[model samples]
Target: MLKEKVALITGSTSGIGLATAHVLAQQGINLVLHGLVSATEGQALANDFIAQYGINAIFDDADLQDVASIERLITKAISTMGSVDILVNNAGIQHTQSAESFPLEKWNAIIAINLSAAFHAIQFALPAMKRQGWGRIINVASVHGLVGSVNKSAYCAAKHGLVGLTKVLALECAEQGITVNAICPGWVDTPLINDQISAIAKQQDSSFEQAKYQLVTAKQPLPEMMAPAQIGEFILFLCSDSAKSITGAALPMDGAWTAQ
Candidate 1:
């Protein structure tokens, strides 16, 4: 369904971003991969996509914390790939600490990358999408966007901001053949959670299996982590013609995390 379309996914080197890239490539979409990785590593991923899917793939190294870097990366991708019909703002960072003790610099950094970067990407990509009269902006938000958690002040704040941005942008583009939405995923089995899991195990003096189950099932009724590929598939569905009418929605794949 995505044949001849071009997609730009930030943080595409691994985890959700990489899985999304692979899923989109399978649909014959050209790819613009972004991440903080060695140039050679990025190129290698690009080559693999090209070889496996016969779709054009390029890589750009971008620092989400820097607006200038994001602008340059989007410009380069547009110049090379012709135009970006799909943009997935998947780049983010997390820090767990009490609000009172959270470093100001760390808070700024998390907000910059998680919240501000999505705004920057949309601002840069919107013009081209407007010209084409068709586009999709998928923001990879989290369940934290809809609910609160202790020791995650910055992360939750940024995600909540992203959710708000998604709604506004979706409304603005509602009649313009462009759709904007945020995917609020619960706990996903990604590298980002690996550290937290290990820490939980140490803190609780529990086995890895026990820790993993507790970490997600404590707040989420579901005991399994949502797979990255499952999220990618949902994105593919959203990009389809059937989803043209769906906009301004903070759809959750949270395994009933917010249902409570």
Candidate 2:
């Protein structure tokens, strides 16, 4: 059922979204890669998928902060790929600050892109999905969604909202053959986590490797950060036929962080 299907993964130029795109492309899924990249760069990345995986590919430079842009993104994907059979809401931004110290602009941006964009994308994507009687929507939430930390009010709020949205959508679309779920991952080995590790290093006067170890072990019992490819593979499983009954779950691949 996944083969030849079109997936629109926001933030597909980097991090987990890119990893997921690669895995899906390997499964013969056509892709609409969305991110902030120049036309040439985006096309180059898309063409790479075509050359390497032999799947149809295109890119949409949609600004997820704007609801109108989110709708346009879905429309553009449908027009370009016939329909986005899989929609991955992976575009996100983060700001590290206490609630009182958080910048208003950062708070707004985090909410818009990290939370509202998924809602807008689902709102737009559901029509075509309902018409076709099959769709997969995966929201890339975080362990923070299931738990919380200091100085991360905006991030926590947005991710928590995403998880709630996933549950509601899943219930509403249960019989529509549209599954909605959130993947709550712990410290995945992405550039974002690398930046956090660097910040920890600078603050604690530790080496990069030490910071990485400390960061992962702080919240996780497993003592290892997860790879982006692992999340990608998990997403692939969620999109597969065997996982058809796994809707409405906020599944945690968090190395037992939330279990603690």
What's each prediction's TM-score?
A: 0.97, 0.97
Clashing pairs in 1: none
Per-residue alpha-carbon lDDT of model 1 for 1-260, expressed as tens digits?
Answer: 57979999998999999999999999999999989899899999899999999999999898888889989988998899999999999988989999999999999999999999999999999999999999999999999999999999999999999999999999999988899989999988998788889999999999888999999899999899988999999888889999999888999999999999
TM-score of 1: 0.97
The alpha-carbon lDDT assigned to residue 35 of candidate 1 equals: 90
lDDT of each: 0.93, 0.93
Off by over 4 Å in 1: none
Summarize candidate 2's per-residue lDDT along 69-179 as a digit string, tens digits: 888889988998899899999999988888988999999999999999999999999999999999999999999899999999999999999999999999999999999
| Model 1 lDDT, residue 243, Cα | 95
Model 2 scores what on Cα lDDT? 0.93
Q: Which stretches of candidate 2 lie over 4 Å from their true place?
A: 202-205
